[model samples]
Target: MNISSLKLDSSNTVLVTGGAGFIGSNLCESLLSNGNTVICLDNFATGKRENIAGFASNNNFTLIEGDIRDLNTCKKACSNVDYVLHQAALGSVPRSINDPITSNDVNVSGFLNMLVGARDANVKRFVYAASSSTYGDSTNMPKVEEIIGKPLSPYAITKYVNELYADIFSNTYGLETIGLRYFNVFGRKQDPNGAYAAVIPKFVMQLMSHESPTINGDGSFSRDFTYIDNVIQMNIRAIASNNKDAINTVYNVAYGERTDLKQLVELLKKYLSEFDSKIKNVETIYGPQRTGDVPHSLASISKAKKLLGYNPEYNIESGLKEAISWYWKNLK
Candidate 1:
């Protein structure tokens, strides 16, 4: 079953943290499209206002300028909300390596605050952005939920800690929660400006600028680059799923297909060249692999498929096409 087939409860008021970021903003828009009231909380730390600019005038949408690291702000955001999609966090393996303490403060401490705030607010469900990096040194081909490797970086540790906190909250406080371990999610609104920007967005930006994109390592590292629409689908289903087996469980949200960095660049070039033929011959520069980076990642989404009925809507090619089109229109 495709994700579009899943049913959602439209009456719920949803609070989306980091709601101005790439995935959060997309989720907020989708929820509004489904006729749900969405309250977006973003600090503008990495989240941009442009991401949610279109929804500003919508009666069903509200934006709050705040950070998730603050308990008071989180408490305020959780009030009268039926569901909490905690997407706020300091992401990127390189960024975490550069500053582990800040990552811990935001991803771990901030996450706990949100969990506590949501529990006290009596929200129906709490879903969060877990990461594929949690499968850190595990040599497994298709990462599973039950088996996890030791976290190789501070970002990975923080995300893994979120799952731990969620479990303890469910067991001790009976606060329902779900964690979706997202693979390389990419699409529109993904910021390509920062030094720690994701591969897809950064590469897209560089290609648009007619500059050579850098490939870390030999460009052979593979990732299960899931699309944004698929992620939004997973969040909606995870929040609304009434299945007993689905609640309080962690699921891998991915396309279940891996594409190497070289292949990814080729695909991006192929698509971008159609818009500007100058990008057709842009060569890639390779650099020594950065620290805290994994060699490969793939997700086995059977758990989500069986329990939450999470069927991803787009594959790499299809998602990239959509993403590229959006960036072309908005960025250039």
Candidate 2:
């Protein structure tokens, strides 16, 4: 979380695709804080303009209303950019299942456009937001970067394809890229209103309203719920690292631990009750397990630790405390 420790160049101009969404917006803020010039390109399909609205007056910030699916837009955004933090993608398994065409068009095609743009522009490093969904049906305890199973859903296929495209781009065009396979990232600014909203923020919103949040299954499904700040750290490290071995490879960005839905809701109730004691009385309901959902997911950040020097500052308990406080203050 120490921006100074990252040793990022203030003079560098970075382009953050999907800069109005949760993780992308956070990256924009962090890069701007370090006195770097930031160009944000987003179609606002899922990203909100208000997320980056605060930067309107900051001279260092620039917003380009465009989608990554368009090669021209990607090329324009990549113009004179030192680095490209590609976060633009249509995310969600059920959403993809509901409509695979749009998902593939955006996640896969859009990714390809950006890769081509970055390659043509000769960007220094192309860091991307890869997904843990790439682990798919794998039952691995501590998901390593190299060991991956077949993708389970259309969304997973798109993300896995992203890694393949990144690898190919690195090899074919000599464009340096690093893919951070994020595991269940959650924190402030994360949207909780959508039908496919992530569990933690969605649960927090429901609990804050005293509504009984429904669990997908008997509540045993687990994930390596990562914090947004930790994710930001890994991205910056990817940019700052001079290690040749780290470039052109993917690394798992996680806290190296897992928490089941049962324990997760308990922790949510525990944290939210600190703001409103009545939250203790709220309940939860069980439902059929969601399709394409793995029973368990954990990560081994050893590769990141060894190469990028990744050290996560927040665990599940600590991360939930911070995230809940933000939701309590901001929740409508």
Candidate 3:
């Protein structure tokens, strides 16, 4: 059985909020793959059960249809869970602009509930999803954790608030918590049909359908698109890191590189056309600039490197190649 290794105590449970969503599902799969018992909580607001479909039959996995905003739900999910990976949140800057209240309720209020729940249950470590949007209006090329700018969108505000609250909780309650400020993470299981869908998946789906994808604002906008495996690796290392300096702190989880939207489009078109030659000449449609999008994003992983030994294994080109292939096989 692939269920008795990895130094995991079979009785020690791990809970992942939003575990049915893209990143959460991937994290759950990796933990289960390494012989850990996992409890996954999701309201399916933006998550899909199909994302975690492959784990349904695994005896070590349990799925709970619940929202993180509910104190009772968080309490129940936290029971006996040794570690908490909080990934539940409503993302997208435009979506937050349109409905800041709901975003606040989930991203802020929901995060507090998980913090309280994890604290009450005495979880060994609480690792949650923080976002690059926190870098906000900063002009710095490679964003470091110590420096940040004013939030430009409701989404950015909410994610930054998560780190702030985590700091408060750790100081006041002595709960060991770590936040990974992920920069443009993308990979398999990322939903492609939503209006607020992320760029990589949306582009892959559109290219697969022979439809044109849109590159907002001259295709010059750049991001440090990290693959999901690297993100999962950060979570593992964040919890497992023995460095006293690493605990109860946040680190930038990214590839320490930048790729423009136009370049990304070219890469997508190039890789996808390999699956179908018809996709070769599919031109992209550029529209008015998106509302809260920062022009460029690059992260400095030096702190994570020194503290957590986090060496990202995939760069954007390699990651996009794998992501495109997955969408071609599964979504086409």
Instruction: Give the candidate number with the greatest lDDT.
Output: 2
lDDT of each: 0.91, 0.93, 0.90
Count the clashes in each prediction: 0, 0, 0
lDDT of 1 by residue, 1-332 (tens): 23334677788899999999999998988888888899999999998888898998999999889888899999999999999999999999989989999999999999999999999999889999999999999998789999989899999999999999999999999999999999999998898887888999999999999999999899999999999888988998898888977999899999999999999999999999989999979999999998889999999999999998777879999999999999999888
Q: Judge candidate 2 against the unseen true structure and give its global Cα lDDT, from 0 to 1.
A: 0.93
Candidate 1 regions with alpha-carbon error over 4 angstroms: 1-5
Candidate 3 Cα errors over 4 Å, as ranges: 1-11
Worst 10 residues of 2 by lDDT: 1-10
Top-TM-score structure, candidate number:
2
- For model 3, residues 10-119, the per-residue Cα lDDT tens digits are 56578999999999999898888777899999999999988889898999999999988899999999999899999999999999999999999999999999999999
Point out the worst 10-residue segment of candidate 1 by lDDT.
Answer: 1-10
**Please, what is the TM-score per model?**
0.97, 0.99, 0.97
Error of 1 at 165 (Å): 0.3
Residue 240, model 2: Cα distance from true site in angstroms:
0.8
C-alpha lDDT (0 to 100) for residue 272 of candidate 1: 95
Tens digits of per-residue lDDT, candidate 2, 186-295, equal 99999999899989989998998899999999998899999999999999999999999999999999999999999999999998888889988898999998988877
